[model samples]
Target: MNANLKGAAMMVAAMAGFAVEDMLLKSAARDVPVGLILMIFGALGTVWFAALAKSRGDRLLNRDLLHPVVGAKSLAEIVGRLFFVLALALAPLSTVSALLQATPLVVVAGAALFFGERVGWRRWSAIAIGFAGVLIVLRPGVDLGWGSVAALLGMLGFALRDLATRGAPKSLSNMVLGVYGFLALVPAGAIMLAVTGGAGVPPAAALGLIATASVVGTGAYYALTSAMRLGEVAVVTPFRYTRLVFALILAALVFGERPDLLTLLGSAVIVGSGVYTLLRSRRETQTAAAQEI
Candidate 1:
């Protein structure tokens, strides 16, 4: 298969994996505390990534994990995963997933502010429109509840993680970064569990669900990493939006939750703006490269 096709396939598979993980975690959340779910989920992920790192002859504990950029990345990872999982447990899967799609827009805006990237007025307008889509979904005057807040926080954390990752040192392998990312989840989960009156005993069925979430979530991470590495950025990046499709399907079939028209409209706007931003960024890069040549 062509690399682009393979990458698109991988990206789709990753989105599917993540959708399954969310479904499982949401199921488990019926009985287990969100924090305990995260603890087990993170533990499994940490072990999985650590083993992979060892297989590649990478050191498990390295100074790279402590680098300022890496530290910021790890912190963002914890916040992202922790709150996202919480949102899954508390919010309608479809709504939270729809809101989560705004991460790339957040990243674009953050890059412009923090990295001094030159975002043209049009892309800035897209970002503004994308955020307006988010507001439409959120409906500020209405009491949308904590789930919306959690989802928004999760998006911000993820955007921060992506931005920091862009500046991370090349010396750290993806596997090493994965290990640190999962490792941060452990303490975050632990703290959450403590504040939530300790971890309650989960039913055996919930334990099974948590285990499934862990495996599928880890697979999603690796699949996403592979997609970005293998495919052209523009070709592969749009596939990330497909997660919303998979999420909506699972939400309807598994949870019997149907999103309203407004949510659908909001999601379409966010996706449209995000894709435009990516294509425009890619065009600018190509133009710059041509001039340099």
Candidate 2:
């Protein structure tokens, strides 16, 4: 198969995995507090990544740990993840997912500012239009609350993390990166737990709920990785838009969220812009590749 076609397929699968992961967590969130959910999700992720490292014989302590900036990036990811859970708890699933479209814009700005990547006017314009679409969906009034704010910050923080990752030392293995990300959550979760008191007593049913959420999350990660391993990276990357479809269905089923006309219009704009971003990125990459040869 063409590598691009393979990558496209894998990316679609990865997007589905992420959507499933979100659905699972959101399902559990109705019954559990945000802090406990974060901890369970984090712990599950840590254990999964750790076991994979062991099975693959990935070294624990390499001299080339992440750069200081990279460490900061990992911390940003922790913050982003926490806010993501908070967002799910606070906003409509589709709305929250739509807000997440801001991440690519943030990443573009971060790349230009932090890495000194030359930002052409065209990409910047696309990003600006994309963010305008986000604002339309959010329509933040006085009642939007801290949850929305947290989700936005999370998106921006994740973008910063990606920028930091680009500068990361090549010596750091993916296993190390995964470990850093998961372990970073521990302290944050502890703090949140201290403040919130750990999701009350887990009812008999809560255990099953939390467990189910964690398992789905782990599976999502596995599916995502497998997709990348099997498919080409650039082509597969655009399939991530499927998360919105999944989130919308889950929101309606789980929380009875139904979108009015404005939401649909905004979503169309965001989706178009996101797909454009992917197409543009792939073009640039191919151009660079051709130049190198």
Q: Clashing residue pairs, candidate 1?
A: none
Clash count of each predicted structure: 0, 5
Q: Give the Cα-based TM-score of candidate 1 against the true structure.
A: 0.96
- Note the Cα lDDT for every prediction shown: 0.88, 0.73
Least well predicted 10-residue stretch by lDDT in candidate 2: 198-207
Writing each residue's lDDT as its tens digit, candidate 2 over 219-243 gives 6666666666766555665676777
State each model's C-alpha RMSD to the native: 1.3, 2.3
Runs in model 1 lying further than 4 Å from the true structure: none
